[model samples]
Target: MSRQRVVLSLISFLLSFISFSQVTTEVDTTKIRIGEQINYKIKVEADSTVLVVFPEGQTFTPLEAVEALKIDTTKKDSKFKLSRIYKLTQFDSGSYTIPRQKIIIGEKPFYTDSLRVDVGTVEVDTTKQKLYDIKPIIEVEKSSSNWWIWLLVILAALALIGFLLWWFVWREKPLTEEEEIALLPPYDRAKLALKKLDNSQYLIRSEVKEYYSELTMIIRKYLDEKVYERSLESTTDELINRLQLLKEGNQFPFSKETLHNLETILKRADLVKFAKSAPDTALIEMDRATIEKEIESVKAVLPEPTEEEKLLDQQYKEAQERKKKRTKVIITVASLVLLLVATYVGFGLKYGFKYVNDTILRDESKELLEGEWIKSAYGYPPVYIETPEVLKRVQDTLSDESKDKIKQRVFVFDDAEHLDIKIITDEVDGGEQGQEDIQRRVVQSIEKIIEEWETKNVQNIITKDDQFITPNNVEGSKTHGTADFPIKGSDETFEGEYAIFSFATKEGMIAHVTLVWAKEDSYAVDIAERIMNSIEMKSDEQANAEQESQN
Candidate 1:
């Protein structure tokens, strides 16, 4: 009997030691006024040789850890007693759970018991606190408006337009010396050419060949313009034969003496030019005189132009002017067009063909992706996010059964073609449900939303469920995949991608953000991802505090 009693006592001692070594948690109070802190203390009794570590961080969700007080340490009979105190609070009035906290003792982990917290709203005395009317909406300028891009585009367009106008119309174009001479009448031009030849020093320098060449070219050019178009290309013998034929045919009533003088002068000029036979200065002067007299004789023999012939000549000059202007316009336009095409090709090679094509064509998705983004807050328990464009509030009609029980606000930006963004916040007027129940309902709501899409003719729905976290560390559930969406006013459907993010708060408020875009648009995909990453949840208290600080 004595041995049995000793065994029972040893077993009781072992049980008591085991209970003392285990961690225990207790809170000062489970109920508190909104924003009031609760003291949560964790106690552990262990051997002095064991190492201990208390939880540190924002792991106590729903109830935020306001501060971690220094741990209390005491020694009793070679055993150490450790107590860690945490100050926690919740800004909004709701029932929240302080999640299990990890406590490390030596190499092993121990968890503190989860605790429930009830935060009650403080009553507002409207009679004492003066009330004011709601303030009017104030417009705030966007931080990143992409004004530089627009400025660049405007400048580029103006440069191109200015260049085109200068090239085609505004520039002062002067005629060349040859063109000025060509514009003169054949007789006047021939007289001018002879005067110019007399001014030359070819004869003084004994350049007989050059002098003869210029003198003969003057007569040939005059004949080519006035009488025979091919005279300049014809040989000296051919020209003389043509003149004789024209005299015989009565085309020109040339005097025999005049023809004989012209033939003699041309043969002498040819000998001086091609045969290298240098004529004396006196003979060269006499030959020049003969050529001058022959030119006058030919002009006298030519019939005077009739009124109709004069009118035709005037019309021909006008036509030539018009042709020159038209040619200038064509050249300018063609050159500009080729320059633009070359620039486009160069940019394409440097960047990519698709990128260049999209920019040149002003693709909507590309513009939105690269344009300035707006950051704003929406709905109660506001969802803060950044987007390409500001979302406009949409009035949604609720079913008669849910009109009194549910209040919903929706904001959206939908082009019905390339991209669509919808943000929804729903507040239910009822008792707070369990977290599991809320999650289940949220999943059902997601399916219902998808079903609604199906009714709208969305097809081939493929979904993948996963967790999504925002840049601010706000976590939510996400459903994303591909689908075929119906195009407006057409029987066709386009391949598209979509993502849905659902977040629920302790106050029974649910916020959902849905994004849909064309599957082939990489720009749209980037925009969507940026929008998602920028998403953050701000409680009314936090928002109000920030606004006050800003003020």
Candidate 2:
């Protein structure tokens, strides 16, 4: 009996020792230099079914854990030997104790033994170390890495300076004498033309056609300058007729012999040129002499203008000069404007107009699209949609009798210009109203809205009604059309596209979403599509609850 008792006590002691040894904690070293890491390890032996969780975060108060290595597990028989290492460090040189950390094993909790650590500063041997003076900062020239940039800047500066010098200093110089002579009076110009014709070799080369053509042109040009304004544009017969009229009207004192001589020469020249009637050289010379004498006679008989006529002519010339200058200025400005517009359009087409407008023009549509969007409910049977801006509740202007029969709400997003988005909800007393009756009422409501649009000066309206299904599979009627409407405060008309979506709930409540925008606005279509796709119709109970709350 005594031996058995002693054996039983030994067995109990061994089991208790093994159970206590299941969890053990140790450190690599208790003393360390300041900021030096200490390896602290924890080991646990548990069955595969038991879960062991180590303390996480800053459980070591005085000594911070810099790193916690992943837990390593090894199977020993039916138990897992789990081990975890924590790297700890302390900056201040002092003695510190790591407090006990609570670890969880299955349902029970266990604590690790508190550890003492000494952090000491590193010792320095000052006597044995050789000291040197701090080196002075050397004054080294910094080589420029972007020399080409400076070169380009200098070249641009030189070019600008050259342009300035030419524009301000050199371009305004006076014209030379030859340039002045080129701008001579009309009489001198006619005389010069005659001299040039005489120096030509047409007559010597037996070129009668060329000679006559030049001779007739010179005479007509002289007459154009001094007498009749349309002489150059008129045929020989037309010129004679005009001259006869002028003589009969007493505008010019032309002699009968002079007119007769002039008519004979022009007719003979036309025959030589057009009919191939080659006149003899003697006859041609005689004709030329006669023409010169006739021109001199006409010059002698030319009348001087009265003082009023001279003033009018001078004023006309000055007005022509001013008009010419203004035309040149307009052409130059228009050319610059066209070039800028072309350049802008080229870039816009290449990168997309939206990109150019958003970057350069700061267009409102682009800003609205790219900006923050809001999802909100509108009207009673609230139509849920996302928009670039919040819709505002507008005043209900329906009569009190109409209001009693129908609970109507109107919300609008009006910019007072191009864009006007409105949503209308009408809850009618559907007592004894069938589906067909409800649909008919919805159609009538849409027609009434269209009539209202017409009253607002919407003309040339073209509407098409179609059945559409929402994303949630709710059936609805869509009325879309385009109309020409006058812009506010302007005579200009804008073509506007409007779409009205009428959705009738099972409870006979009609939700009408209306979108109106200028047809030219490219973003309006996208915005309208987005709003239509995002439509979510509320349930009857929710709609009734909202109505009750509103009431």
Candidate 3:
């Protein structure tokens, strides 16, 4: 019984100790403002080490992050204790739920109830649960992007206003004649411009082309606009020639040295501009100085006249006048020659007898060479060819003119497509010794040969002239306003004033022609070919038909 009592007592003591060792937790406050840390303490008198798990979003919203997660360790005799301190804040101003969290004490689970936080706009007790927040910066941004631009715009507007105000005042106030004259820049302004050039630091740095260009222009423009009124835009050579009329001297504004230097610069510039040459720096620099001095040398003085100078001036004026007159005369003569050759050449010689310019000649073309034959612009005009010269080479070559009967044919044509022809003069004129004589002689010779021949016409020779005639009677031949013309080929009486003349029809065919007449004296083969080649008979139907039949 004693032993039993001892064991029971021991068991009771062990139970008391174990029950007392269970861990329990208590919180100082259930909720607090942001940054006011709440004290949560866990009291335990346990035998083994304890581990705790903290809630994630339940403890703090992600955006309202934990500032600090600190572990506090303390020792009590031989026991180890661990506690966590979380420093947390919320950027949001709202009531939020802290979700219930689990705490395990040796596998016995305990859960804390959900807590609400009230963050207010006030200072709080930090020793307790205090809320502290950084105050917003109180500064007002002073914008340079704003008032500065506005001020600048205002300043510009004010400046423009001021300018306009001043301009209106000045402009509205009328100037007396003398005052106006005073306002006019003096003639010495040219001198001032040159002085500025001489003193310019821009020149020393050798901005050569610029310096020379400026210098030359000032002086040249002064001459062009004020003195001679000539276009200095002209070539340097032209400018010099113009100024050469003024006179030569130191006082000439264009002194010899200055003129020469200006000439050199202009010429060098021309070489660069036209000849495509690039000048060396040294030459450019020298030219710059030369121009500067030239510009400076245009002083206020008059050029003097001398007897020799006056004579030369007069002579030059006369020469220029004569040249102008000569040019006009040459142009006139050229135009006349052009008109004269226009019709014969199928274009005016004046471009090919652009006789379209002459009203009279346009109306009556034959009037061009109606007078007695004389040497003309055309070489050896109205040249006559003897019958013997026409046949000189062909004389022996001719099949004895006696192949029984001499068959000669004349077909006048405008186109070379067929044996087509045109008749300019189908009547006969008896020969005499006058303008009429030469013409009739040229006509009758052709008619006599065809008229007396036993003529044959194989096809209808298309004579294009309105007046076509059979190569028959002299006075009785078909003439004008009718188509009586025939293509003649045959034997006998090969003589008289019938000839052919060929022309360029410009109708996609070789020649425009007229069956004409000249005397028994024959013309050159060139003349004969001229007539024959002019007549292009249509493609021979008989021959073409034969070809088709053969095919």
Highest-scoring model, TM-score: 1
Model 2, range 272-357, lDDT digits (tens) per residue?
88899999989988888877787788787788779999999899989987896677567656655776698789989898876776
**Model 3: per-residue Cα lDDT over 343-421, one tens digit each:** 4565444443434444345422222222122211110011112111111111111153322122112222222111232
Q: Which candidate, 1 or 3, would have the higher TM-score against the true structure? A: 1
Residues 372-443 of candidate 1: C-alpha lDDT, one tens digit per residue: 888998875468989998899998657978755666778999864678899888776553578887798789
Task: Score residue 293 of candidate 1 by CA lDDT.
Answer: 85
Candidates sorted by lDDT, best first:
1, 2, 3
> Model 3 residue 500 lDDT?
41
TM-scores vs. true structure, each candidate: 0.67, 0.36, 0.21
Model 3 has an lDDT value of 0.45
Worst 10 residues of 1 by lDDT: 542-551
Q: Give each model's whole-structure lDDT.
A: 0.83, 0.79, 0.45
Clashes of each: 0, 0, 45
Give the TM-score ranking, best first: 1, 2, 3
Alpha carbon RMSD to native, model 2: 21.2
Task: For model 1, name the residue pairs that clash.
Answer: none
Question: Model 2, which residues run further than 4 Å from truth?
Answer: 1-350, 353-359, 430-432, 539-551
